[model samples]
Target: MMMTMATAAAVAVEDSTTDDVQPLSTLKMQAAQVAMDSGAVIHASPDVLGKNGEDSAWVTVNVTAPSPSAGHWVALFSPADFGYGLPSYLLVYMFANVSPSFMSSGSGNLRFLVINQRSDYAFGLFSGGKDNPKLIAISNKVSFANSKAPVFPRLSQGKEWNEMAVTWTSGYNINEAYPFVEWKMKGGESSKRTPAGTLTYTRRHLYSYQIGHELPDGTVVWGKSSTFRASPFPGQDSLQRVVVFGDMGIGQRDGSNELAGFQPGAQVTTDRLIKDLPNYDAVFHIGDLSYSNGFLAQWDQFTAQIEPIASKVPYMVASNVVVLCRCSGNHERTYQDTGGFYNGNDSRGECGVPAETYFYVPAENRGKFWYAADHGMFRFCVGDRCFSSVDRKHQPWLVFAAHRPLGYSSNDYYATEGSFSEPMGRTLQGLWQKHRVDLAIYGHVHNYERTCPVYENTCMDGKSKQDKGSYSGAMGGTIHVVAGTGGAKLRDYSAGPSPQWSVVRDKSFGYVKLTATDHSSLRVEFIHSDDGAAHDAFDITRDYKDVLACTVDSCAPHTMAN
Candidate 1:
């Protein structure tokens, strides 16, 4: 997730070594030198794709180069007319050396998993390396059967607990075709239709739906059908499970883009979530989703990667930038003279515009990039750049989440800074303590670590290993959990001795699951994505009275005379 577009002719560089080397960033695209070769021919088969209502399809590319070298490579570009102008998107690239016999045979065949990105595509052969790519061959145009078809339905909870919001991507506008969702209760006799931008829900019933664009001629361009269960009523006492993680970048199934590097465990974790989809009711990908940086097409690849899970559950998201006052990754927000706190060019020319445009959340103002959501007994104050007050009586579990480690983390870089968190992260300490926040979760360190119930650098509870895994009564402080193990290369903990407040640390690719059995108890587990097993876990047993009890600065003042 730590990657971004270059601001100029050179690639953007960051202080951290963990920045993902975006495959698309390797090319000197702006100043590319053209040397079209007649002997070198490039072609892609099954040019017309998505013929079976599929949003994505596999295409085979054949390359014949009279003179090939190790530096030779290929690129996928959209809006096919790459020679006239820069392609709208440089979708993906791979080295010609991938084929074992490519150098000797002067020909190679490669498989690519291409999604319908609302544009036609062309494959280009390059003679020189990424730094001085010389386009030698251009393939014929390839496109989906209906490039404007509505697709990639992403689910999110509406402002109301019983309401579900569905957002999707389509090439059509309201004037071209009316967008709507046709749905029905799983067992209902008749189905009903709701306009695309409207809410659709009824209690916790499972509903099946199809998103489509209704043409003026009464025809329809339908996307894949999917099903989802509505959120339970607010504070409803039931077994509620939630999946939380961060920093998951895109993975290539065909292995075309991995040569330059990508999130190695992204597909594994994505498949795990899909396999375990029946268990969790919702997901909170706190930040760094897609890691598109400024490569716009990668966003489509990321959405298609998570479609199986997002299309089913409420796939909540947050920004990856500074948690307190920022709402997206430095790669999404930081640009020279943009007024972002971080003074850099990590986002190339994009200043949070693409991310804000691509995703939908329950935030009051999408520009603010913060929101409050309720799932049964849990109340989540997600990505609030400012302190947002909440009523904790009904939803007894008050949790706060943001992208960076705003509370605590012994990440080596943060350790060097002596803050144990992103600079200014602890600004929320007063708010969390005053509001009695139970848990504060974060991602961005690219590892898993859980602190003891702690405040102000002190472990408020569980000082002994024997007492570490469980808690009860009026827990005095918030438990900070970092679950940034969603596939980007795992980072190392500080080389120094483990901090006392640090209860557990694991450098595994996994996610955190919080299961609320009832208002009286909560079970938290760190489940490894590989085996789907809980490697670290803890429990909190308390009651409504416990939540009301004073802890540190949590309670209001009272007069003893009373």
Candidate 2:
């Protein structure tokens, strides 16, 4: 898939526990005291799964204890040897109360969805609730047909417009197997192989490819085949669609992990994206992806959840086009005294390791977390560490994309701070105005919000008599959009009156789709995930001259000598 471009600066507010805490953190595993009940039993079946090469499977778990209570719970652990592993990744956990009759009957059957994360799994029954979990019984080991089979093949635009990069995860190392992508032009007779680390030129043609690992014996273990249309040439006039959203943590299809009320909209948004896969070309998950926080196992779950859309299209967690501009979000990079701008322990101790290691973006230094990418007529200066400098003559749409809203928002959290945005949110105001950025999109607020062309807290268009739905001619100021509505619990707008520049706010599960009909017209729509309908939209209509025209403080210095 074609990861695109964006740019911005990092300025964050400390997130509240209600919004950013990882679910697993509620469990005090370190203090867990084993209270074995010989008569109590926990069993999971069928003992095997994924016989058809499926990546995920649903299993039924039956548990019985001497005295079932609200405190009793069940957890799925990976590596099958959770006893000795000081910190085992818990794949999923749920209270026995969810079974409805467990409290009275002392036994109940629950269902769980498990994925091929290249590991073995087991279910454990525990008592004493989350604060003081007690292991009672363990289920027999459950395994997939091929636990180490290559899975979750993600695509990113390569360093060049014509190049594409495919990355995946597997159990085999170089000595055991060689990883490569087998590709062919759509319907072509012959196919070619590109080894891992080598770029494959797909250009603009429709191509089909599959990830595989060649074993020492020369036998090939292949993943499912998928197709993607290559990115159009930069500056090309063609219809382009890109999806942007943030804070979408992993969704529990089996209904586990609901106690925390985290990310209720995640699965629906994911389903909407999958259903509308044919309509858009690429996706940008701006930040707070997976909400994994610190439990590393959730990363696998997040990847499994997004594989359907990502494996087939260009799903960018970082890159917008060619540049990987990033300042890791609190959940991805922050830890106490970790040198991050924020002093929160939101990352639990992850400190950006999993995020930097898991995803591939074309960053000069992956640790810095920022880069640039181009898609047709759109120029994305996507990073949070600094401002992006771009020539707007060819790609008129200069966008600043980040995980946090550095532009404008009216969420209650920021509203109370009296800034209506993150602390130091507008520190980059001068840079944005100087670059004439058309739109700045962000994802930390957990709600939908849009601003009219605004600068310095003033609505540039409100005074110009410009229509709200359609903007034409020179964009006097950048339009800021907060689309953190990609799952996670939705937040409410400020109880106070809406700011004049805050044109719209919707507490719904949805994403923003930017459709560039051509070089001169861009349409942005906030599509609700529940019904796959656009609840709000606006269009920007302008000519190349309008882009070059002076806007507030963005005009070049005048020279009479010329």
Candidate 3:
């Protein structure tokens, strides 16, 4: 199972009352709710109180299927249209990468997995496609409804081409149904069923989102491309381009700027990404992804808005939870403080603990969230060459996506707190240098700034061979970039004097575009969200002098070892 460079693809309501009708409040007392099969129809009634309050309370009328009568509710489209009007590349990618459907209910839970031969990241190929997608977890056929998984699948789950995985969650730990995903590629004749497992997942989950622009002919719908494999071009072995940005808050619907018609920040960015689909292979939403820290629903809207682009490609993401206002910080920041954003321990409780108080960190969040993520990913990306390789995108370049700047970036927020390095707090700074990381991409300051290749507040050695707006990363310093202009409000530079190593800064709504060339060179560009302008561009030449060759024993010569 060898996978090459990843690729990009362009990128859920209820019911009514009837004999199959019931009330949600009944959910509390009844042992269980309706037990229906996939695509089954059921009705629900809302509890209504009248003139006499509790004494005279009455139930809202349940209309027939989709009647929309008082208290009537219905589930549309079987599991509901995850997304539609997708292009071809996206569909193929999903079978190897993401989930096509997810369901759970009191009757039972369903977790469909797309397992394949483990992937060989070196070439992005799998020896065998999975038998049939498996339902890793299921409850019973009675309650065939379930929510989506809680996290996204990691880029390395199916490390072997013969062993990919599609995972989901069940509301209940108990099991009942002999679960399976009976599926076939669209237009094929028969569907097959492969048995699923009932186990607690200690990893990522998947949720569907859509992003598109309205056109006279028709709206190019995109959503279901939630999970997709990373593939190289017909002859190439690396990605040609990838989009990067951060601090994207779901745009508000106002009559001002940042909106294309009624669409706002997130929507605007989504539309841009979709239209430019073929030009880029993947997306890197570094940090501060959804400015919806406080209101989690904003996360829903942001994802839905970006479906057209995200579904078709591998959307890699991280976290940023500082200065997010109280509510937002309450939910998002905990991941950073206690390193347990997803799973909380007694020390942190539901909220997170302070810096040094915990005896031990919880298992779930330990390897996943915040700055700890930096350490985890550092090792993941810088690991071995073949079998145990996690950061398989090792050939062309090594880029890091974090929420805050690790070096000087012309930002003002932390200037008064005594320079940019203080907030960074040493942990990330050390690991980066040790790993010899080439590029550091961040968002948070809301403005874009480019720093000369620098280390320890000093220019390491090289300078761009090209002009200012377009330079070479081959320069001796590590290029520090702040692409915070994704969609959040902009921030001005600190009052006086750009740092000695600061090269350029742009204040606008835009994102980044990266191109990898076969010459072991990486070209980075900043693209505007409003107008597709190349505000900034640069190239970094990667040195693969010692990149090891892969094999069980004997191996071929290294392509990148110069």
Candidate 4:
């Protein structure tokens, strides 16, 4: 295992002419750029790490520079867009002279066992845009003096049905092994465990792991919007009861922890999910699943806290990624402890990595967070507008989820930090409009809000609230909903008359429930997770006459070429 972790990976950038790097036709990650500094050039390549007639398809990572040469070796991930930063770039092995370990591979590469225990890491949502790694360390530390806990989080490939990458965080150098997951039909009895495969997520650096006491100083950097998060499979085709909301605080890492005494929004929601298990099938957390900015423990606490509900229903994550990743305003780079504040990726201790590790034990037995990633929210076309029915299973709707609000939102502090609309929101507005999206969901701003059926940033269909919410028409305008009231600190609508586009807005600890009524009819209601009050709602009747529908068969999940 130690030998495989070292210099066994493939792909190293070489001079334009002759080189030893293998062909790039089939590999998912190929080194495409090499920036030289101080006469020192970086070199590395991948070699199959399979053993005993078995093929794991895994490769070794090789790094090298001329010996006795006057310079430092630096290998940068390429296209300057793959988002390859330290978090995703794990330096498991280093060449002999540049060693940082007690052992070396047969090929002379030093090996690194990055994480040791659950208390030692954290990874955030896909916060590092373009250069976002799958995971990163939030707190890299090992404690023989104190007992610690870990977290579990399994991400859907975000591009395929029933496909997920279940990962565990926190394995010590002494106890090295990856977590395993066993899944079957929701109602099936017993099944064998399926290895979701283990990935060495770490702090981005020459020696990615924490070395004794130095504490990792870089964030992992995986680039470009490679894939989507998780969601339920084929649920779009049936009449499924779904929960929609964002900003479910994982509890504050700062001294004030709502989980200790207060009823956190996530807890309230979990309590409700328990009592009303049959009433829903999945959850769509638009954004802020865990507010574990830098405190990796928060990720552990939040997943453990929501186990009851998330285990049974699919909890989908939006905002973690964007459509096509055209810009950087996805909100992952803001927080001081995580994100771009990661100080050049030297270290991103925990972007929310522990959730994967701590939960794997019991999480394997009790059920874990669920959600599949589907990126078919909108369809863009030029002269002759195009609209495709999304679910071939006769499901007729297109719902969009994001962390930040694109329209009909009261903005305040986020803009100052460059998260609200500088990039993501504005970048998506046109795409949403072009596709004539039906429902748009968000959570970053912590408050519950619903906009009048709107299009082109205008409240085209005005607003009306029957005993249940009602909209004038369906296909013409896109309804925008914000349920950020998920237990974190609440914020007031900006200090001014509510925007005309906003129909119902409230400051409450709640979430929105969406029901796909039929081919042309869908209903959405915002319910306070605290008390069972149906605070707000709206229904859309598919014009059937004009909405373009993308058949489920026609729209395979989105995949990244790189």
Candidate 5:
């Protein structure tokens, strides 16, 4: 059950001399050939001839759908050697009814399936005449939602066109809702349902869905096109790695300038970081991506500059303190507020944008800003930028991270007293104490300070006024390390004499390297950017009971008198 259609057009190729070759008359043919010797139906198009060889040529192929249960498949072949073990050529397959719209409603859903010949990294791009755009995810049948399966293989000189099949199940009527069976791939066999003794997909379980085949180094590469296939499983794993950061607005000197140093030159650092991102899992930006004080142009520049990174990765963001808007008496409404340094002093009703936003890390914890991920033995507790709540179920070994810090040096400029004014301080502290969170990583501070694990301003030491070094062995303390000096301006350090909780403090541009040894031991190293050397290092170990023994009772919080 197969139908084929092909169209021929002239294409120009560039030669070594950088001159466009003359357009040649090319007849593009596409046919369904079942056996090698005995050919199947051959679909041919008229030969396309052009006067100039300097132009590009395009050919279109359309294939018919198989019977409801016939399981039809399609593969594209390059002109050089359409057969296996041939030269390198691009193979493209196109299908009809890729996304059918329903009559009752205007919405339509499109699905595609893609497979690679060997293990090589590839991405897909879509371009058309219209501006209509939508979100899409590529995944395999088994782990489409969680992308646990390795990517499809890549095509070497020996390998031929890899088959990418898209199977469509007719959509039901608008009023009807059907339960599709879930699909599972185990030991390379597709399983419609879990076998008698097989393990089924669980909410807490983490699995990899391979979009294509994996390379020798376990790197999965995707195909260039979108293919849709019906899977036995109800849902597919289509997750990608993303990185998110916000509150990176343009400021006069303090805010923007400082932030620029760390992520300097608008898009320089951000672009490089984004470009260097390892095909990420996903990005969750809390807020303040770009400061939209009054003018829309600033926002445009920031967004445009960030496109390099955001376009590649899923740029999930929240609102922040810098966005401008208005305040309604009863119902808070936000329009464009152009009342900042960049924009004119017109009262254009610009209000600061609200930041507490949310996105999902599918196959992981969902519906919460604070989510957990199991990267190696360490469980990363990425707190909601708002730092409001914590989910205990998803992440077991909690290691929290946020933009703001609850504790800090007693610098008058940005005093620590009012820093934790938001409920985040109490909420996160309580959660950390309850779960014995191994490490709490934070930014925002211009300086870097590592605090011995202390709760409620009290170091775990029961002794008071003890020598500075006396409280060194305070076990189980939540080490509050500040590594905000990624590239930000260095803040002035004012170390208190015999400070009880503050273990180490440094005013330098640097980043922290966190290595998780296991569920129990974790190593944190602060690398100073000046010399590319680690200035400070520390080790934190959890007890057999899984509780961090360090408490605020031992090392008392520093007071003005001390």
Candidate 6:
């Protein structure tokens, strides 16, 4: 059952404190003064009061704390309930400290103890030092059991405001899921209540709290307070925006490099991109990410190269033919030929070399090389560069992406078909017509091209386009786009009247940004790396009224392409 917040009767504390604790008062005064200096405001009361019988209180405080330092404290206690056994949750946010591990540096601290109850278990945020802000868990009332540390680009300093939040998902379910407590220390050591045994949480009934912190002696200070219940899927409410491109091998075609005209080889340029990555939840690698040539060392370097970006977002991939061809016929060839497949098996293999790691799709779709995932209003259909059969199931949304384009110009000597050709055009075109995929993306052309919505070589008029296509009114007429211009060598465009189906084509190094505003409208823009210019863009809208409604027989295979 879904959980909802209940309005519990508020019970004001009668005595306020069991005993007038001088040390606690002193600490509060010092924190308040420091917060005032740092331009922060401290509320005199709790930010949130627990519901009746729910034993929990959250208070926000201001501290004028220096950054990169540690050891500060805040206290929380319920006046109505003094005994233990009734568990509660807490969450804190740091509004000032941006240091890598500000939590431990005393940027923000929290302390809570059951007046009469023994602590069971606890899970929330903590910072060990300037380098160790981690999500820690304690069990069995002993040592730290689990921790997830943040991987920041570099140590942070200054009065930059940052936030540290904690949520306790379970308090009861002792023995089954142990109870715990979390607290910040006055000096440096942070404390957490340990559980008697192991604990596991099925439904996340997270109780949240937030507060603000400040430091005066150059000690790290942060501010925070509970906001609202966050969505289980972070970033889901935002439109699913993704930058798709591939074949980026270190350098660029234009004088400026990756990320739209950023200076070539400028570390800050890449850093900026990494820092801004949270704006988008995922990325699609059409192919040729590192030009590693199946060399484990190169692959390692490649991974390291994109660590700044990959560490934060979901990096999805399609295969690159060059990576495949280079390793072909060698002992390494067997292992690298497939997208992480081994000996004809779908499972990933350790091909004796670090570069032998295979590319596996997300686990949700059976880890098949091809799969589909819906982000907000748009559904992305990712296909394996090698397998066409996977396209059968998800054909309706077969907005295919791979290293090679089914249709291409002959300007490049390698554009012709050979033994490796799988006739993707014939198969995908039939399927596109049957299911009417909205868009197909590919790399390997080493350039960029946007095709008019087309099927069987015929341009689809906007008026003729259907809102619901074969896959529920969810899909529209399919358009194919190529965005391989990510620093790799550039290829000349195919000479001619540019197929009637071609809408926009460019040889500049760049990336494509896709924005889905709703079920029927999508906006795509091509940003050039040469001048940070938006070279081309277009809007594709579906007329839901034109979509053929699905029926038992209408949804059959005959209605779809084989």
Model 3 per-residue lDDT at 414: 58
Candidate 5 TM-score to native: 0.40
Instruction: Say which candidate scores most in lDDT.
Output: 1
Better of 1 and 2 by TM-score: 1
Candidate 3 C-alpha lDDT tens digits along 1-562: 1111110110000111132111111212122223223432322222211122111111111111111112211211111222221111101111111111111122211112111111100001111123211111111111111221111221212222222233321122223222232323334335333334211222222222211112245532111224343334222444456677876655532211113321235556666777887787556665555443232323333444454555455555543322221111122333323432222221122232211111111113322322212111122121112123224244435566555565556676656654463254244544445445567777766788887766667665444424444433234435778887777567688878877777778888889887766536667788888878788887665445422322121233456765
Against the reference, the lDDT scores of all candidates come to: 0.79, 0.78, 0.39, 0.41, 0.33, 0.38
TM-score of 4: 0.53
The TM-score values for the models, in the order shown, are 0.93, 0.92, 0.51, 0.53, 0.40, 0.46
For 39-152, candidate 4 gives per-residue lDDT tens digits of 222222222121221111222223333332111111222112223243333211112334332123212232222212222221111111123222111211112121121222
Instruction: Give per-model CA RMSD.
Output: 4.2, 3.9, 19.2, 19.2, 21.3, 21.3
Q: What is the lDDT for 353 in model 6?
A: 31
Q: CA shift at 411, candidate 4, in angstroms?
A: 4.4
The lDDT, on a scale of 0 to 1, for candidate 5 is: 0.33
User: Which regions in candidate 1 have their CA more than 4 angstroms from the true location?
Assistant: 1-19, 83-88, 320-326, 383-391, 558-562
After superposing candidate 2, which stretches have Cα over 4 Å from the reference?
A: 1-15, 82-88, 319-326, 384-391, 416-427, 463-466, 559-562
Q: Output candidate 2 Cα RMSD.
A: 3.9
Worst 10 residues of 6 by lDDT: 149-158
Badly placed stretches (over 4 Å) of model 3 are 1-229, 232-236, 252-264, 320-331, 335-367, 370-394, 418-422, 425-427, 462-475, 546-562
Q: Total backbone clashes of model 3?
A: 75
